[model samples]
Target: MTESDGERRPAGELEASVLAALWSAGNPMSAAQVRAAIPQPLARTTVATLLIRLHEKGVVGRSPAARGFLYFPVADSHGLTARRMHQELDQDHDRSTVLARFVEGLGPDDEAELRRLLEGGGQ
Candidate 1:
C-alpha cells in the first residue's frame, strides 16, 4: 500500500519500518523525509521521536540539519543483524552450548556458507 493508504502497524513494527526506510534512502534524512518514505501516515513529531529513540539505541545517527537533524542508519541490515546476534550470544553464560545449538539449527546452505567462512574462503 502507499504511504497515504495503509493500516496502522502494530507495536514495534514502526521502528523496523522506519529503519527500513532509512536503509532504502541510502542517506541521512530528516524526520519529514522519513515520514514521506514510510508506507503509512505518520506524524512529523512521531517520526522525530522514533528517530531519537533509535539514536539512543545506537541504531541510528543524527546531525544538525536545517532546523532539526538528519538521521541515518549506523549499520546496514546485515551489520545490524550480526550485531544483534553477537549481543544475544554475549548474554548467555554457556557460549559454546549456545553456538553449538545455533550451528545445529542452520540449514544446509547456511551451514556450508558458515563452514566456508570459517575456512577463510572469501568466495
Candidate 2:
C-alpha cells in the first residue's frame, strides 16, 4: 500500500483501532498495548505513528508516567466522532460541499439516523 514519495497515509482506521483499544482497556495504554490489541498485529512503529497523529488531532490524551506517555481517548466514541467531524468542518472550505459529500457517503440506516439526529429526535 505504498504511495508516492512523502505523501501522508490515511490514519482514520488506525486511529479508530487505537481509540477502541484504549476504551476497552479502561485505562491509558502504550503503543505496544495498542499494537497488541490490533487483530492483525501491526508494527509498533505503525501504532506509534497513529498515536502521534491522534495526539496531533487533539483526540488522544496523554499522561507523563514514570515509563513514558500513556495514551487514552480524550472523549467517548460518539463524542470523539462528533469532535472529529466538527474539527473537519472547522477547516476553511466549502462547508456545504463537504457535508453534502459526507452525507452522500452514508448508508441507509446511517442516513436515517443522521436525519433523526439533525431533526432533534435523539437525546
CA RMSD, predictions in order: 3.9, 5.2
Clashing pairs in 2: none
Worst 10 residues of 1 by lDDT: 3-12
Write one digit per residue (lDDT tens) for candidate 2, span 1-123: 566555654567667778888899989988887889876557788888888888987888898867668999888999977886798898947999998899999999999998998899986
lDDT of each residue in 7-123, candidate 1, tens digit only: 566647999989999999999999999999998677888888899999998999999997899999999989999989999999999999999999999999999999999999975
C-alpha TM-scores of all predictions: 0.85, 0.64
Q: Among these predicted structures, which one has the highest lDDT?
A: 1
Shift of residue 19 alpha carbon in model 2, Å? 1.1
**What are the runs in model 1 whose C-alpha is more than 4 Å off?**
1-8
Give candidate 1's TM-score.
Answer: 0.85
Least lDDT summed over 10 consecutive residues: which range in candidate 2?
Answer: 1-10
